[model samples]
Target: MKQKELQIGNLTLRRPIFQGGMGVGVSLGGLAGAVAAAGGAGAISAAQIGFREPDFDTNTVEANLRAMGKELQKARGRAEGGVVGFNIMVAMQHYADYVKQAVKLGADFIVSGAGLPVDLPEYAAGSNVKLAPIVSTEKSAGVILKYWARKFERVPDFLVIEGPKAGGHLGFTGEQLTSFDEAAYGEEVKRIIAKVREYEARFQKKIPVVLGGGISGMEKAARAFALGADAIQAATRFVTTEECDADPRYKQAYLDAREEDILLIKSPVGLPGRAIRNVFADRVMSGERIAPERCRGCIKGCRPTEIPYCITEALIRAVKGDRENGLLFCGADAWKAERIETVQQVVDDLLG
Candidate 1:
């Protein structure tokens, strides 16, 4: 099959691929810009995006909000007019404000997940920024689309299906992730697409569906297209790319990973995630809990004293190359990374 461009409203991405948003300094403007310049849509993760800002420790909110615009600017500088957007999680403590800020900064699109972004339209009101809600199952998709239609009289510009094999915080239960059945999941994807089509028909507009999670290469991408996806989102595959915003050591971890090294972990936010097994993860899995030294108030309803470990700090450490002490969130196929390739090379390999 020939490569197709992903279309959302009037926007066009030369390659039907999305560089999935990795967080805590992972997918930043540099990486996103490179992907967009390479012909695919690029997404900058808004999770703790301002960690590198000097005032982050003192004025976390301000620093993060400030960083958002700066990151968008950086991406635009390198996007070459290609599609570039932000991936903001609904579970964020300042989710509403983040959405509002993103629109104010003129983000081309905003893809939200980590919870049902039911009020996303409201937050992005009066803006031309396209919106997308990330969902893993048909129920969530139906609920979001129906709610948006009833409440906002609109449908999403696009939809992202974060499959069970995705990294970081997942939408699936531990049981579901452990007992994943590809054929069964493919049926789920079909149902979700069908549900989106219902809204598309009602609104008389196209709503592209993008599939992600464990999209390691062309074969998996082909499966996603077979499942009715208009595009594929890949995070882990991008992590090993030279343009990725992560430190060299972070890329090294992916290169060194083996099939047995990746494991499913329970995140502090009460969600199951995939990561590379290491000392930090092993310690936590052994029933040892460490209190966060400081609270950035990143996630909603998260109590610093009650969680297993500080996700922000751990991810920061990982991005800075402290592999043994930080969280190494990655897709199930992280072990397959053989070397650090350029963003253009990876995109061509996957979309060609």
Candidate 2:
């Protein structure tokens, strides 16, 4: 296959891969910057990004906001002028503030989801920062695009159509996942692309569609592109890379997993997340409840008592190398990762 660049609005990336933003410090400057250095668009996650800060436990929001600039600067510094962006979820408090901060710090784009980012353009208004929304179905794609067009008289720079096999906080319901049909979903992706083209033609700008979810390698990316995707955004494949910010033990967990070890877990954010089944997951699934010492205020409606467990703490534990008791997020095909490789190698394999 001949490789191509992903042109989103005015920004151009030689590699069509967009590194999906894994949270709690998974895809920080090191991983994101390396991807950009390898000619792909690297993404830094804004979820509890400041967990490493000393005062993060006491001052969650402030620490997170403060760390945003530092992380973005670090990523930009290492990107070598390649495309770099942030992934800020809509469920975050003051989501617009995060968006504006990214634009203020001169980010190239913002990929948002975890809920529809209806007001995304409001904060990005008058700025050159491109905005892209992650969607699973055509209805959501229509809702956001239509709202943006009606309110801001604008359209997205690009769209990420993530399918059911994605890891960590999926957009589909359990019922939907059980009944998921690829041929039907492919038609859905096509429907969303048609809608995006409608806006693209209206604004006389291109809205490249980057499809994700279980896009494990070259063959999957090729299939998605054949289904109308202009680019690909992969998260799990990057987790096992040498440049990825995950702890070595955490990466090893992916290497050790089998097909049956992959399981669906519930998130505090009220979404189904795909992860490798471990001691922690077993405890949760068997009705064992654990309390968190403090609330990071990471999710929209997260009240510690009513939830399964503190997602922030679990993800933090996983990223810091605690595997047995930590939540290990991975794509459905993560068991296919047999060894650690470089970001360049992963890119080459997918686009080679």
Candidate 3:
């Protein structure tokens, strides 16, 4: 099969594979740059992107923004001007700040999700950086498009359709995620594509659509392309790559996992997320006693009293290499990855 290039605004990706953004220092300089260098779109997760810098937690917003700029510049240098972007979650405490930081850092694009990015266009005005939103359903896409159209009179440069099987904090409930019909999503994809096309026609430009979540291999990528996707975004497969920013032990966990080990677990952020079953998850599920300490206040609507544990602390521990205490977010087939490989090899396999 011949590979097709994906064009998003002024940026052109030779490979239709996009390395899905993972947060808290997972997809930073090494992995993101390597993927971009290999002709794929490399996205840096801006969720706590300043964690690598000293005094990251206590720094002011401007200082943290500077740190993000430095890291993004490092990635740009590594990619030699390849496509590089930042993934900023709308649900994050400082979403607008991060978006402005990414733009100031010369990011080629910005992908926002986890909530409706209704105000994204306002922040992106006068910037060349392409804007994209991750949507799970056609209704969600319509809402964002309508808001952007009415408020900013602008449409997204591209769109990413995330499915139920994606890693990290999911948009669907545990029951819906497990029971939702995959066949039904096909129609949903077509419907969203039609909505995007409506704007594309109005604007007289092409708006590429990328499908994300649980897309691991060329076969799946092909299916997505056939179903109206111009590209596919993958995250878990990148975790096992040599250039991944995650700790070696974290990669090993994915390699050592089995199909059964990947399950949908309750998130402290008031969402159901898919993660690898570990001791932490077991303890939480078994009604074991757990307490929420000082609230980081990361998510907007978190109920510390009712939630079992703090998500920020758990993910921070995982990124810091404390495997036993961290929540390892992964796709549905995370257990299928049996070994570690280079970023290029992973891209090649997906492009094959």
Q: Estimate each model's TM-score.
A: 0.99, 0.98, 0.96
How do the residues 204-253 of candidate 3 rate in per-residue lDDT, one tens digit apiece? 88889999888888888788888899988999999998999999988988
Model 3's lDDT to the true fold? 0.85
The local distance difference test score of model 1 is 0.92
lDDT of 1 by residue, 157-256 (tens): 9999999999999999999999999999999999999999988888999999999999998889998999899999998999988889999999999999
lDDT of 2 by residue, 1-352 (tens): 7578877767788988999999988999889999998899999999889999999999887788889888877877888788999999998877877888888888888999999998888888888998999999989999998998999888888998889999888999988886888889989988999999999889998889999999998998888889888888899999999988889999999999999999998887668889999999999999888888777777877787788799989999999999999999989999999999999999999888
Best by lDDT: 1
Clash counts for all predictions: 0, 0, 0
Count of clashing pairs, candidate 1: 0
Q: Is candidate 1 or candidate 3 better by lDDT?
A: 1
Error of 3 at 318 (Å): 1.0
lDDT (0 to 1) per candidate: 0.92, 0.89, 0.85
How accurate locally is residue 119 in candidate 1, as Cα lDDT from 0 to 100? 99
Q: Which segments of model 3 are wrong by more than 4 Å?
A: 60-63, 303-306
Give the poorly placed runs of model 2, Cα more than 4 Å off: none
In model 3, what lDDT does residue 54 have?
72
Candidate 2, residue 326: Cα displacement in angstroms equals 1.0
